[model samples]
Target: MKIVKRILKIVIALIGLLLLTGIITLWLDSSGTNYLKINKNESQFGNSYLIKNVNIIPMNQDTVLVDKMVYIKEGIIKKIADTIEVNGIQIFNGEDKYLTPGLIDMHVHVWDRYELGLYLSNGVTAVRNLWGMPMHLRIKEDAMADNIFSPAFFTTGPKLTGSEFVGDDNLNLSNPSEAKEKVILYKDRGYDFIKTYYGLDKEIFDAVIEQAKISEIDIVAHPSQKVAFSYHLNPQIKSIEHAEEIVQQPLQFDLDVIKLQPIIDSISQSKHTRYSTTITVFNNIYQMMMDDSILDSESLEFMNPLILKVDSENQFNRWFNAKQEDSTTVSRIKKQHDFHITIVKKLHEAGVTIVCGTDAGIGVTLPGFSIHKELAFYKEAGLSNYEILKTATINASQTHSMMSQLGTVEEGKIANLLLVDENPLVTLSTLKNPICVFVKGRKLNRETLDSFNEKAKNRKNLMASTLRYLENLAIGK
Candidate 1:
């Protein structure tokens, strides 16, 4: 009896120690003390600014209003007229410049806070992070409060997958009751949305949808292999991620484009269903697998060294080595990319809403840089420059349900504008470099933005990176 009692005490003591360690780790991770620190420009919000004589691509229409003056005060556009009579306002010469609504990347995986500046420097004014944790929640709060130099941030809770995919960040539901419980938990915790992963079963998916509706939350998902593509096209699901699921449905790999009409029609008719074109990330993966490029030209210099090292040693190198052993794998990936581009064009032509997404922070897709590459892919897929830009601007806002205040450059809307040297409507590449960006009415000039880029590249949060590397290693990710 004494031996058993002593064993019980030892077990309890061990459990207490484990719980204490977990709490400490959570505190350290969520505190942001280990994050890269960037100096914030001391510009007061609510200050008046006048941008004179610029051409405005309002994004509400496919036309440019030339020689216009935009007046902003208190983070809102007060007027966009031929002239505005105001004193004690900072005046910026917008001569021969183009002004447009800042770009939005609808899907991203945010691993660190420093990536925020990277997004803003590249003119991405808003982002929807697909995966979330305690650290992400804190970052979201900070961004919303203007405590950090970030884009308009939104995030979903940690991914809900099946037990087959095991990870500390993933909620692996085994039954309907568990699914419902997880949904409610995320809703109460203030996650912007719920994200379902690839391994989810149909029964759990249905439960999640029902619970999400009850919780007044939305769900974004990748179509499960266990379910039909049509199953995920329900009105409750906000958007479908990746092109592979849709492409795999037809069975015949080389089917005529005409045969895809029925599928396209269904998607267009769903009304609530939007597709995220993560084509550039796939293209990046293909290039890496084929040994064509070590890293994308745009992402080479700006990616965090710790992240680059882990990806090179684990994800990219492994895939590249495997592809070399089997040349057919490379061909398959290339074919899939071709099909994805074709489907994007078809979906756009069919009047289905397509949101710009790059699946950045995965593989070779750099945070801020990949959004431009994604836009370029849309152009290559036969979309006009205006249409391609809309995917990241108007369509993104609509998909995220922020259209009332975002998606356009107009009076009364939040002042998130980008100034470019050339017309993006004519040359989408101009978006890759912004002369200056106004995030929530606070202007970040070229030099300040460049400083952000330099800080992000050089400042490696070793503690955070080491923790992440250890976690990924334990999970064999």
Candidate 2:
């Protein structure tokens, strides 16, 4: 009896040790070390889908499906068919909602801490931040690892620029050599791409492009003063920010710039290069500063309140509509905008892929809701509704090289999807009514995204308001 008691005590102690070890291991794994999140064994709601009932929209033209049920497990679509023969699997009735890939906004900014909440709220599962703060990147890293709730973030880490006014918070590179070094540093630091801001000289831009290509990084450029529009023809530069051809006024200097159209077409044709046109930026800027009446428009509902709350405080105010007083300047800006639209039309005609991007979280471009505005602008610029939708959905996935895992709702794809109350096919603006969003099969409704936003916004607004008050205090009335 004594021996048996001693053995029992030893066994109990060993079991306790094992249990403690397991808990510690799980805690570390869940401590925000990675971006991949998994939500398992949840009941599916919606149409009782069978394999044959799942509709697959392969962004690629080669494969397609219709009316098939898809089986999802471990955060990925396991199979599709008229019927899946798995037992104890939850079925999500996907009949009411067409399963397409989660929308991608290739060009966006998330400087505000609460920006991620807005992105998720809009059913944007993946975003490529052209420029981002280091702190945002860290938070993104944590969010990816399930440490916090956020979108899948990929960014340039910092802007390589010479302008101090680019933003109060930006990594400034004064020279080409510095720019090259910065690109490598960011690449080493796990940045997804290289972003060049305005003011870098041609030499710096070229150097940055060369180094970026060599480092296996995609180079995205904003309209820089020092570089001519012709630079985009270079194969090394992969994508151009804001419509590449529109921002620059037509210059008559003795250079081959007239050939810009052909070069642009060639780059657009290149499988290696992609274009992200943030037309919403142009529309908003023109409306806010040029027309002034856009501020009072009902469309501004899509704008983030936080951005409107802080615009006066951020000094990089590049908001201005060109005054027609100088006929030449106004004509030039108008001509340029027209030229950009023409180029997009030409590019589309030539089969060059275009990615829909909204430069949200910067200046007048609002978060969460700006994407719909971008589509509207795309339509205004000559693209049909189908083309614009493809730009935001399927084409965007291809631009980011995420065709397999993203950009479509199909078997063997991540179950990141959006369910809208209305059909977005008829009206692009209806994409805003997101009933539910799924990131890695973890379904979040409008309420979830809104809840996250409320929590994040309260803290964020407090800080912003405090800063504003301090700035006024510093001015001493």
lDDT of each: 0.80, 0.62
Per-residue error (Å), model 1, residue 327: 1.9
lDDT, candidate 1, 1-477, per-residue tens: 999999999999999997687666545644543332323444433346899989999998999999999998867899999988898878888986999999999889887767888898899989999977666677778877766667888888878898787876577788999899888888777789889887788898899999998988888987776677778887778888986667765435654577777888888888889999699877876878766566645555566556676664467777777787987888888888888888898899889899999998777788998999899889888999999989999888887564457779989988888999999999889998899888778777888778778767745465565555455445411
Worst 10 residues of 2 by lDDT: 32-41
In terms of TM-score, how similar is model 1 to the real structure?
0.87
Clashes of 1: 0
After superposition, the stretches of candidate 1 with alpha carbons farther than 4 Å from their true spots are 1-47, 249-259, 292-301, 468-477
Stretches of candidate 2 exceeding 4 Å from the true structure: 1-54, 62-64, 162-170, 174-176, 244-266, 290-339, 402-404, 421-427, 449-477
> Over the stretch 1-477, how does candidate 2's per-residue lDDT look in tens digits?
999999999999999997686556434433422222333333442222233344555454433455666776766777767667877555556555545567788888664445666778777887888755554466567656754446667776567777453645455666777878887888877777777777777777888888988888877777576666656656666677766444353333212335556655655557666678777765554445455455545544444454555662241233432353443544444555655666566667667778888888666676767887777767776787667778877777766452447777766777777765445555566577676777766667777767655544423243343333343244311
Using TM-score as the measure, which candidate wins? 1
